[model samples]
Target: MHSDRGGQYCGNVYRQLLHDHQTVRSQSRRGDCYDNAQAESLWSRLKTEVLEVRERPVFADLADAQRSVADYFDYYNHERRHSRIDYQTMYHSHQQLTTLSTLNCPA
Candidate 1:
């Protein structure tokens, strides 16, 4: 439910739909650019990297679109870098978890 403070993003119909599904709405604070900056960054990356690819961005089937989105999510979680986490990709963080555990182990 986290989104920018835009009227069209969670307009009346969308709000009603969420209400029907019993979901809470959360929005960024007004006039604060960084409040929901992470969500904005993810959306920008999805559109630019997944939807606007060079080999034409139209999907002829629902499964294709779903697969494409899934692939992007996998890449985002595994390969993408985040500065907040010392510029380490998520894949590396998970890998380093076992490394740290092994170092701390007695045997």
Candidate 2:
């Protein structure tokens, strides 16, 4: 639901898809570049890892591209170690947070 104020996000096709799913639309305040930094960073990494290394970044088909991107994200979330979180894997961090939250809840 969170995105920059891009034209496509405000367009009918995208709005309709969100409406159909009953999701709220949220956008960053105009002119706030920092609000989108995380997404931009991810895009930069994806392009560098999968697209920019090759001369022709085009895939044989759309599904191939989707699969490649999905695989990259899966690896990023489940396997890649992040120095920001004491070099822990993202999956472990998420599990720890989940366990902490569950323990904090009343029986």
Candidate 3:
């Protein structure tokens, strides 16, 4: 997983957790926005296309807002077309990963 050099990410506990999962942690260099541009872009799109368009929300209503945004993310991953991913949904990309799992096997 990729993360900034935040305190939470730099903690020994966090590093151990990732090590347990055999994850190769990639940390962005300090003051390098370009290192995390893709994440920044995604958040920007979500905020502009979803959050900014919504009416002012109450703190008590935060859960509902988060849920709505989560749903939109699902739709974007599974339905929306993107030239970068060759117009395939993220869901489709995941399916491609397990295509070999569907190979002929005895019942």
RMSD of each: 5.0, 2.3, 5.4
Error of 1 at 89 (Å): 1.3
> What C-alpha lDDT values do all the predictions have?
0.83, 0.88, 0.82
lDDT of 3 by residue, 1-107 (tens): 99988899999999999999999999999998799887877788788878787776622477886788798889878897767778898789778767756765455
Writing each residue's lDDT as its tens digit, candidate 1 over 1-107 gives: 77787887668998898899998988888899999776778889999987777465478689998998898889887988878779898778878998999999997
Per-candidate TM-score against the hidden true structure: 0.71, 0.78, 0.59
Where does candidate 3 stray beyond 4 Å? 6-26, 31-34, 58-60, 97-107
Off by over 4 Å in 2: 20-23, 31-34
Better of 1 and 3 by lDDT: 1
Give lDDT for model 1: 0.83
Quick one: ranking by TM-score, best first?
2, 1, 3
> Residue 80: error of model 1 in Å?
2.8
What TM-score does prediction 2 earn?
0.78
Candidate 1 vs 2: which has more TM-score: 2
**Candidate 2 local lDDT, 1-107, one digit each (tens):** 99999999989999999999999999888999999887887788788887887566567789988998999899888888878778998889999999999999899
